[model samples]
Target: MSRNAEHDHSLVMGLDFGTDSVRALVVDAATGEELAGEVAYYRRWSAGMYCDPAENRFRQHPLDYIEGMEAAVRGALAKLPPGAAARVVGIGVDTTGSTPAPVDVHGRPLALLPEFSENPNAMFILWKDHTAVEEAGEINHAARHWGGTDFTKYVGGVYSSEWFWAKILHVLRHDEDVRSAAFSWVEQCDWIPALLTGTEDPRRIKRSRCAAGHKAMWHEDWGGLPPEEFLVHIDPLLQGLPGRLYTATYTADKPAGRLTPAWAERLGLPPGIPVAVGAVDAHVGAVGGGITPGVLVKIMGTSTCDIMVVPKEKIGTKLISGICGQVDGSVIPGLIGLEAGQSAYGDVYAWFKELLSWPLKALLPESSLVNRETGEKLRRELEDDLLRRLSEEAAWIPAGSTGLLALDWLNGRRTPYADQTLKGAVVGLTLGSTAPKVFRALVEATAFGSKAINEHLMKEGLEIREVIALGGIARKNDFVMQVLADVLDMPIKVAAADQACALGAAMFGAVAAGLYPKVEEAQKKMGRGFSQAYTPDPEKAATYQNLYKDYLNLGKMLEAAWSSAGEATPLR
Candidate 1:
């Protein structure tokens, strides 16, 4: 196959490895037109299994990711033109952040080892895993006592249980086999490329600065990794791990390497096709959605990740506290990437649905016409119709009609106040309240949570000029988006593409192939999308503002109650 010139419209592939599945998109390098795409669900036995609440553990098999990758690539290729695969110039990958995999010296997962096959600690820790809450608390205490010299500043002021070190500490303290057998702790963002290329060198594995700085306690001012002395305070094993794990060369647009000959052939593509360093799904979604400087891109789904880019000039020496991370060139070159998020969004709806206790007969009234196999179908149909109707009815009840306010701490807060120990709460519910009213309260609560984050950003001099919303929830839930807009009193720009993260990864492929000079450049050229601006309604905004004040007062009251009673506060 002959290589096309830089301006030629060759095909580029962007593969997004999400928490549930891997999605791939083949796009035209010049026009950003999506030529083909595919999604492959993970087939692991314990794909979505969460460990005990006390431990906060979550695990996934490495084989599941590998299988999903292969399946997505094959599925995408099948939809492309017969000769397009050969013409593909580069590929890029993005994944859920803070997901860590324990690997041996050869980059193979420790779970694959005979001795550690059954050990869950040897498997990949999903980003949502909070098993290391205790360990994270210890790290936070140490960082504060250490006088801000630690690298924890990069990640809002405290290390999260969701990150690499905390999970590693949890496993090391609990699982002897995993601790003894693990040679390295790798980020999922880096591991995918390492697995494809079959290399274990620190130089070979492209660690995304977006993930490292945001989730692994890395800062450029302190030369990337945390100080050795600080790591020693947290855990003696992490002392020397920093030296081995540190990397200075962090650029999102740079090509990490080329596809290995074996992988290329297996996937029906040419060898030496450029592969860009991996990125966080939300960060890449910003690039893919064409959110440039001053724009906040909200990648909303199970959770919502708010991403923004700022020029180096705007970021003064003052460290912006209470955010996911601010890494230079992590999203676009010469810019700082800032991330904030809600730990729960759409999950709240799912949780409510699961808690609904409906009689089987009531849910399946047409049982005579529907067989046992189709009973589930009928139940789902009824449930969906009811939910939709409830949503519509809830919209008519007016803001604050329920005489209730809620704290969206169901899954804990991910930004501004990055606390995971908090629990959800609802106050002022009366006997007259219905399920739809409660549901509306929950939806409003999430919007208020977003408003809190936005307020914090504005206070910190990070002017959020516009919001670009993307992901499944943003597309499916108009009520949620409109409520959010009203609560924040800002226009919400929804992305046109349903799979913005996957498309964003594909944009990186265009940059790696030299089709564009930067990720943003590629986005402008090929990233297709229109923003649906939901102008805030003045009346609704006023009502929400009053309710938000009540919500804040409720938060304080709850905190005081928890303290006085010596009980844990609900809503982290």
Candidate 2:
């Protein structure tokens, strides 16, 4: 119950490798006070890098992660109090998951090799990538009818193209060079900690239970990954690759290893500091936001990741249907971490913003309203403040006033049956609809998507005790949170920390450094309190209840059409 005296002046650093950027945070391990933080965006990634969104082929070069992490660390260290770096004793990392890349025997991502540097197939297959849609379909078909252990059981009811095996298979089938060369695959979360700890050897990399169970179909019940026979049946190329993969996985509470001398020198940190095993960003974000049993925390950013922890005994033998998998020790040690998400949330709003401003960009190239020369700055101002102004206007319109509804699936569905081929739709649109109406409908669509995920969890008998929300959107957008509260008919608490994921990583860092016994103990000392609470309006909740049924009908209609066209419908 007492703080560590030796660590009283010490700090633990947390690095969060997100989709667009890597963020660093320096926190006092004893007092839980944040000292400094930094964010370094992937420079090449921002400029469209090696990605082709049009093809659903999103890839990130290894150097982006490497440079960004170091830059973020340097940026954070530079802002800290003089001599603070010497006080830093441990490091923790978290990143977007299912983002696995093929690596050589030496543990180098193939994309970093000179010959494969530009090959998309050799790069990290991002979680949002849908290039493996067909491959995922093949996996689902094999799992359902193959008469072996259903690998998809633990990973929701469906395997997603956005996950490990499907992405790997897609690359293997399409790129002969990569197929012949890749010795093994490594998830980004696993690779980063291993990279820092000075071991990339596939044999020695400590895989994360969070990443492997949720995305890679790894379960202790199956002994490890799916049997080699089952994998070979799906594709002969998979022979022996399972052996190359790990059987044991560790939770973030444990130390992955000591920081290597090379990385310590590169990052200007002390050598031999313990590095905690990595996890997906949102799982750690849950810890940062104080996710306990029955408390659900939503990391609402470009996309939404809902994280919850429950007693392992309570979750016994109940494979919650159609969710991003649940894993023991995924969030905190001795508990089960449950994950679910919408692939598009703020992205739906971003899509609406782009849709409304398309003609301005496409048709008004030289107009005084848009040009830099103009004092009015109408176009530039609009581009910057569109969402804010629209949010204000959208707030005025009553729930369901748009007579329109949208499916929040611009990036395809990610949860409650993880189908990537499912597309978005705006139904009931009429000539009377304006930009504000359309925008509000899009926002409502995301809220509705969240409700569906909640419903799925509830159907599996998991009670919704308390709802906590965090991340960029949750903290910034009051209107969205209120709308979400109405849709779910639940009061929502939003975390105050601007960088909750980084704080969570620091909690792990503290525990790994022996500052605390477990993640829960560290969280009690380091947790960021809620900044705001949104209570659902009775009238709005009543209105949304009816609208939700309509939304469900629309989804069924679209999904039926998609299924009839030979694509699989989401599992119930």
Candidate 3:
């Protein structure tokens, strides 16, 4: 067979570790064909262990990740043709991030140790966890007043509780056992690649540029992380912590190392296959969707991650304010990746569903209308169909027909200034307000939140030439997309691939394995063009324009109220 024919048959695997599950996708590197995919939910996470929604603490055990990855990879391989597994030459990984875990000197998560088995602080602190709000506030204050370099300049000028340093400080200050045992910390993206490559020493593990630059205050300007003197000023507990962590970071296109024999055997893949460096899910998804200059890719799932890449020369010395971060090579090599997002998106709708279903959960099994089994089945059916039914009904209510207005801050705002202390609100509620009308208002509120981020980006001189959407909500929900298009007054394109993030990882994997010379070549060969487009309706756009002004005014009012009540200081 010719070299071109051999290239056409090569395969790669993309592993995506999400909030609730892990997804593995097997792809043809030459054709972009998705051979097979499997999703495995984390058993412990599904059982609701080690998380407290009331306290805003969400942690995941390393065992869940290990087990789920094995199951997903093996399951995906089993669905392929006989002997197809041997064709796999590379693996790429992406995970929800700024999700950092405490690790011992050997680069093992603390949760794996017998002594810290049950401690939440020992597990991976999930990105949605907001227990570190006070710590984040202190960091933000110190970054501005410390008389040294402003470390938070590139990260939207505000550090978030949902990020790396704040979470580590929160855990260290609260848990003495974990603090003593932890020799270093690792982001979920960095940890997975390190585990696969058998890089056990904390200092030797390859850190992800995507994770380190975006969440860890790592920049080329300051020689990596903030200086030790500045950290000690934030808190004495953070003293000397910087010395144990990494200084160098690599982009996803580079190979972290070859997959170890143990990991390869467990996943039914060959030993010594190149493993591409890991990255946050949104950045990977952007690559899968064919992101380019002036284009924005929004990964909309439970929350939303908006990603855009600009040339390094174009973004020189311009710090975009009120975003997540702008990091070099965080997405594509030689480009600066800019991220911004909401802490809650579909989650806002889920909250309403849970609230409305309280009576069904509380009374279904006890009712005389049915037996326990039948009641349980009925409850499940109702809950599963609730969003679909709401969307159908909500679609009929024209914009501004409902006077209700809401704030999509139930989990607190993530971008346009990161503040977790702010709570969601619903105003203009009356006896005549039906469930669907209120739901429409909620959907509009989320769209308004997105527009805020876009406006902020454009305000800082980044042009959004086009908008692309991906993830579960983007694929499944039509009402939300149409409303979003109307609110932003821009047409939105939905990526065709169901698992764009996983597919993106595979593209990077192909590059790492030398199947392609660069990411652009891989993307051109493997990219799945958009499936559909949502065009803005001019009349509806006009209506949303007026409604958007109302949203901003109400948001300002709420911020003032919070500040006056001493609940929190407005960061912006």
Best by TM-score: 3
What are the runs in model 1 whose C-alpha is more than 4 Å off? Answer: 1-7, 45-47, 50-55, 357-371, 383-387, 560-572
Candidate 2: count the clashes: 0
Structural similarity to truth (TM-score) of each candidate: 0.93, 0.96, 0.98
Give each model's clash number. Answer: 5, 0, 0
lDDT, candidate 1, at 300: 88
lDDT of 2: 0.88
Candidate no. 1 TM-score: 0.93
Candidate 2 off by > 4 Å: 1-7, 367-380, 564-572
Which should have the higher TM-score, number 1 or number 3? 3
Order the numbered candidates by lDDT, best leading. Answer: 3, 2, 1
The per-residue C-alpha lDDT of model 3 at residue 167 equals 99
Estimate, for each residue in 361-386, the C-alpha lDDT of model 3 and write its tens digit. 99998999899999999999999999
Local distance difference test scores for all models: 0.78, 0.88, 0.92
Per-residue error at 58 for model 1, in Å? Answer: 2.1
Q: What is the lDDT of residue 432 in candidate 3?
A: 97
